[model samples]
Target: MAFTICYAGFRSGFFTIDHIHTVKQLIEKCHEYNRPLAVTFIDYEKVFDSIEHWAVFHALYHYDLDSLVENFNDLQRTLQQLYDACMWVGLKMNMSKTKVMANIYNVTNPSATVGSEMLEIVDLKTRLYNQCVLPTMTWTLTQEAVYRMRVAQRTMERVMLGIKLIDRVTNDQIRSRTKVKDVGNRITKLNWS
Candidate 1:
């Protein structure tokens, strides 16, 4: 099920809040029952906004399903079917961006593939923090902290480039040679995003 903001009509309902509440309730139920829950969040890279509205509805209607698979093989098959369906509708899935997350209790190392590339597996909480929380927190860094980060990054870059402090290379020269963005600028871009 999907809950989206109603942009064209009356905006009385808090759909985003309701969606979060529903997810929270599902998590609580899973915890209470001591059952493992695996969730896959698919990023479409603005596929809906780029496509015709009716095409979006047609794609959804063609691939709608609500069921749980019994094993990783079944999951792989299901993902293959999904990939085929998306390709049939002229949508491409970026396999590199796809990730599979499972709880610690899950013994099998979950393996899934779309076409020939294997999807990466990541720890759920770590991925959530890295993707959701860390970017926001980066904006709050003090000047000193940012300076330290830049110093560390420059040191690493210098090491990779076989340069040393005694080499008499200027910071601007090193940066021009390395072609990497400054830590502060990267953080600013992250905050804006």
Candidate 2:
């Protein structure tokens, strides 16, 4: 349920340097506070086509959330309504044809699915060190940077896989299985190495 803030004033792109700087500062502050942090991008430009239109209206009516929250009761009521709406929508969600959150109770699909997939892949890679790939002596500053680079490369590949999968799905083509298998191969290669 990510929203893309697009100001028509800026023609170059959706986000600017200020946005990055603000996010960087926020992440830095989270680290300083010893809070677990995660950054993810979600695209909802074409979400309407995939969603049940009536369900969105149903959610809006049931939740009746305030644009501004005043109290706990309001929050509870709003949450209940929202949950009901999501449940109605999810029941109709095509599992075989539609991709939802892979391993969560939340709405991880709707385009943020890529972020979850990448996070899962990163978690998998991180486990390698726990399995004795990186000893204390070798897990110094330089090795940590190299490990980060590898993670970044794998993340990029996973992102590419998401793009390819989405394209295939949208185009109504016959390459879905092949695309998934290709991503699986890449994941296997990463794990084996």
Candidate 3:
């Protein structure tokens, strides 16, 4: 069974950045040691609403995973076992959304299958770029949007400082008094990080 970290609602202290860093370190270590590493990402369709809690607990209690999976066959077997368990629990795995990533030094292609479908293999770099960078690249702020945001910020600042446009206050003076970061600069910093 796959365990996912949920960051919604009141959950605290578990961040996605920690997972990304851990994965990066694992990949680096595997590359440095010239070890073959294959990672499978599984996605379940409608897990929360479809699956029953009692069935989930029963599946977890019955499932036995003892040894480390060393190769593709073992991985495939493990996946099949997981698929069976999930099927028993009324949870459906989305085959199209599942993907496997392996190290570049691996000579043989890692073929992992669930039921009759073969999972797609993706390059780590491509996957990372697509997930992390592509969205940032595609997020464009229009001039009108930026102007509106700035105006809103100024209005908020004026309300906080109890000042109006007739007060003849400069934006720099208001910004210095308010000590708040500019929206544009904040966005730039967020994108950089």
List TM-score per model, in order.
0.51, 0.25, 0.53
Model 1 stretches astray by more than 4 angstroms: 1-16, 45-49, 126-193
Regions of candidate 2 where Cα sits further than 4 Å from its true position: 1-15, 45-193
Candidate number with greatest lDDT: 3
- Candidate 2, backbone clash total: 0
Candidates sorted by lDDT, best first: 3, 1, 2
* Tens-place lDDT digits, model 3, residues 1-193: 3344532222366677776687788878877787777788889898777976657655655786422466778888988988898898888889999988775555444588898999997656445533554344323477666566667777766765557899999999887655555666655566632
For candidate 2, write residues 1-193 as lDDT tens digits: 4223522223355657767787679656744664433333323324456676555655655555443233334433443454455556652322223221121111222122221232121222233333433232132234455556445444444443344444544422322311222222333445532
Number of the top-ranking candidate, with TM-score as the measure: 3
**Which pairs clash (backbone N, Cα, C closer than 3 Å) in model 1?**
none
Clash numbers, per candidate = 0, 0, 0
The superposed Cα distance between candidate 1 and the true structure at residue 122, in angstroms, equals 1.9
RMSD of each: 12.7, 16.1, 17.4
lDDT (10s digit) by residue, model 1, range 109-183: 567777897877665544453455445445567778887777876785575445799998988877765455566
